[model samples]
Target: MSEIVIRTASARQGDIARRAEAMGVDDVFISDLVETFYARVQANETLGPVFEAAIGDEWTPHLHTMKQFWSSIALNAGTYGGRPIPAHHKHLDKIKSEHFSIWLALFAQTLHDIAPSPEAAAFFLERAERIGENFQSILFK
Candidate 1:
């Protein structure tokens, strides 16, 4: 499969080859990712409460948004069109940098658990790091 894999030029510049490859996963699309990811996130000691509080019983919509988000990210489907910044803005005062870090950690761990793939899993974590850092910057600002 490595021959079919393509190395990303730079993660900072929208490296998405890994995502593209992962998109071929028919059984596990954005919905699966979100469903599986959130389950692990809820069980995670560090990230669960924060997400639960922010999400409450509204995890359904959030899950849908996540499905769209990852779909846009991996499949280039552009189905994700929500403003997380504003959503985060609401309860961000309760969040800390560690929240994002732990979230990423758990996300990476979850990805590893679901399907073992060097390139795809690494790309997911890389994107998480970039996006999490962006959130942290905004939070601290």
Candidate 2:
């Protein structure tokens, strides 16, 4: 038998996914992000009440869709393709541009806590930034 070697380094990508999955990121990341985001949104003077009212009866389905969205992005699951622009367009009517920033910040912070790699944390935050920018542009522009 040949001698075996063990490495203790983490890859920028693979380890991130592994750590994230172990942290329940694949299964719970999105909902956790959304719940934190919504709490901030609900406490904001400009957007709080709007989300509380308009988001009524839509929590579970919305959370399901968000999980599918995140899994597809983070795991190549291809589980999401819905036109969320329209779904968010309605909410944009009541929110300020700054609301997206708050969402991104909270999302990044949450993922950072659970992410296993800088790359993974960066990947998640970058996606959140992109989504916030895209949604704000399409709806507010």
Candidate 3:
């Protein structure tokens, strides 16, 4: 593995071991955030179709993956190991700028509705925005 990946994993492992020191985030909060955001995605007219087509009857596995993903992001739990870039790249044809806007909006709202604190919400939102920007650049450029 590259040094960057190795360092990142090491940092994340330390983070997971340290736990509440990062931002007071916990597993339950991440779970709630992922679940609520996905539920909103499922009901959304614009995003629902794309996600449904990609996910279909695999919601259970998807949800589990999402939980792990958010946990990895919010808590650096190292629970998820999948690559998000390639995953999103596979749906590049279905994604658009507006889709990212809607996603960020829903993510922000989910954080507001379920986050443990304002700082936690801001923390996650900042990361989400960065991730969205990166995805947009790759998908559009």
**lDDT tens string, model 3, 60-140?**
899999889888776666789988888888886787778999999999999888877788889889999999899889878
Off by over 4 Å in 1: 1-19, 22-27
Model 3, C-alpha of 51: deviation from truth (Å): 0.6
Task: Tell me each candidate's TM-score.
Answer: 0.78, 0.69, 0.83
Better of 1 and 2 by TM-score: 1
Tell me the lDDT of candidate 2. Answer: 0.71
Say which candidate scores most in TM-score: 3
Error of 2 at 38 (Å): 4.4
Cα deviation of 127 in candidate 3 (Å)?
0.3
Best by lDDT: 3
Q: In model 3, how large is the Cα lDDT of residue 100?
A: 91
Candidate 3 has its poorest 10 consecutive residues by lDDT at 15-24
Q: Candidate 3, clashing residue pairs?
A: none
Clashing pairs in 1: none
